[model samples]
Target: MKVLLTGATGFIGSKLLPVLTQEKYDVYTIGRSNLDYAKHTKLDLKDNFAIENLMQSLKPDICLNLAWFVKHKIYWNSDENLDCLSLSTKLMKEFYKNNPNGIFYGFGTFYQYLHDTHIGNNLYTKSKIKTYEILKDFASLSNYKTSWGFIHNVYGKGEPSEKIISYLITKLRNKEEVFVQNPFNKFDFINVVDIANQIFYAIKNNYIGDFDICYGTSFTTQEIAYMICDILNVSKDLIKINHQSDQKFEISSKPLDIYKNINIKDRLCEMIDNL
Candidate 1:
């Protein structure tokens, strides 16, 4: 099978690239530059013309779209939200027009159901929710088949951002004190490898429609810091954990419903050990 991957060098994409290769699929990756993947095409996805043009030339069998601007903290408005969706819609239309039979996997986030609420307090969350709504609605009526994968917090190696796990690991490595916010806020995190495996499964198995993939285990920030301390064989007391009441916005305490018959507890523990 021939596949087109967006954000192929991202945290999930980098890990996913090798998985596709191991499965022996002909993969074409789209991004700003080339990496260690099947074939590379440099095209800025933000430009509709460039995206459509590249899709026309490549004619990939399927497109796994995972490109998006991510930020740790931001508040987005309606116009900003729509703009992000517009880009996604244009990309989808271009891919569908070129490869009508190709499948499109729209990578979404856990903020689909939260907007204008405490959980939606974050601007990034609102934008992601808008993106999901747009894609889900388009997929329902679009001629080509499409699927939406609502992913939870992802953690693994090669993560581009100085994110939660990486940040904590970095501070711990330097033997520096790290202060975390919202210790009581329950957040769902999944291993990047497991998420990539699910996406690969969806592609190979011809999965269409919306699916939620999560680790099912909710860990607090303090707990995560403790895990890191344990992994580094350092005193947990050195890692100062303070609860930020202001940052403790309201959010769903429940975990995402995963359909896969896989256990992630041991895997999460192993990740902690990998530190």
Candidate 2:
């Protein structure tokens, strides 16, 4: 299968590259930087003519888009969200126009499923929600085989430092005391590799429509901290849990047990030891 991938350098997308190649996919990546692992084009996606040319040239059987404006805490309301929204919509339209029989998979955030009372005013969430709405119409007109993977709290190597797992690993590895807010708030985290695997499984099996990319297990921030400390063989006393009401804006997403044998602790240990 020929696959055209965006955000090939991102956490989840990076993992997908290797997986797709091993599955015999002719992966062509679009990004700002060069990647020796796949056929790559360093093109700016904002250039509409360039994007249209690439789509007609590649006409890939699958388009995996994972690019967007994302920062630590500001993405929820960033002005860049609007730019991403516009760019993604244009990209999808061009792809569907060129290869009406191909597949398009866009990564969405868990915030898309949160109650309106929690994220109704959120631009990032609203944009993602809107993107899926557009995707549904496109699928109807095309091959009717599109995918939107709703993801949250992903942890693994190369993950952003702002995430709780990365934050705890950095602090605990240094043997420094770390204070955790939302200690009791439950969150389910998936390893980036597992996330990539799940995505490939869906594409390979021809699964369509909206799906949640997660482990279907919830753990508190404090619990994750302790787990990291245990893996590092550090004293658990370094974990200071702050008392606060849980952020109940979580969504109960369905878990596809594609990687049921995945061990979270083992992945954590690998990340810690490699540091």
Candidate 3:
């Protein structure tokens, strides 16, 4: 299969690239930076003309759209979210124009569903929901296969330092005190490798539709902090919780039977040790 991948240098893309290669798929990666593995075409996704030309030339069997503005704290309110939504829509149109029978898989976030009660409160979540809605409608009318993978919190190596797990690991490594707000907020954290594996499975099995990629388990901020402390052999006293800032967030009520065999604590420890 000839696969066209955007954001190939990203945390998930970097890991997924090798998996696709090992599966003997013909992969062409599009990103701002040149990648070490697979054939890379360095072009910004914002360049619509370049994206169109690339799509016309490659006409891949599958296009995996993983590019997005992910500055963690700032991304929720950033204008870049809208920019990504626009660019992704254009890219999808171009891909379908050139490869009508191909599959287009895009990434969504758990925040999109979690924030349904207060839609448009966060630009990132709103943009994702809008993008998915628009693209899903377009795909239905165009008779192309499309799927949206709603991802929960993904923790693993090569993640940005601002991400929760990476940030805590950095602070612990430096022996700095960690302060957490909304300690009671529960989240489903999945390892990047498992996410990559699921993507592979979806492509290989032709799983077409909206589905979540999560660990099927929820962990509180305090629980995860304690796990980090235990892994780093640090005192629990170093971790402070701000009760005043606590807010209850919705956890996934959907059953995730796909990852039943996976042990999250072991995976968390492995990630912590690697860091």
Cα lDDT of all candidates, in order?
0.72, 0.81, 0.84
RMSD of 1: 3.7
Residue pairs of candidate 2 with colliding backbone atoms? none
TM-score, structure 3 vs. true: 0.91
How well is each residue in 1-275 modelled by candidate 3, as lDDT tens digits? 99998888888988899999999999999888877764898887788889889989999989999989886677888999998999889988998999888999999988877664453368898899899999999999968899989988898987877788888878877789888877888888889999998888888988788888887778887888888888778888888888754347757734244576677779878887787
Question: What are the runs in model 2 whose C-alpha is more than 4 Å off?
Answer: 115-121, 141-143, 243-246
Stretch of 10 with least lDDT, candidate 3 = 249-258
Which candidate achieves the best TM-score against the true structure?
3
lDDT of 2 at 135: 82
Please write out the lDDT profile of model 1 over residues 94-116, one tens digit for every residue.
87888888888888877665554
Candidate 1: where are CA atoms >4 Å away? Answer: 36-38, 71-84, 173-176, 246-275
Ranking by lDDT: 3, 2, 1
lDDT of 2 by residue, 1-275 (tens): 88998988877888998999999989999976677763899877678889889998988888999888777787889988887878788878888888887888988987776636544469888988888888888678645568889886787877678677778889888999999986766667778888899999988987778888987776777877888988889999999878664454455767775865556777778877765
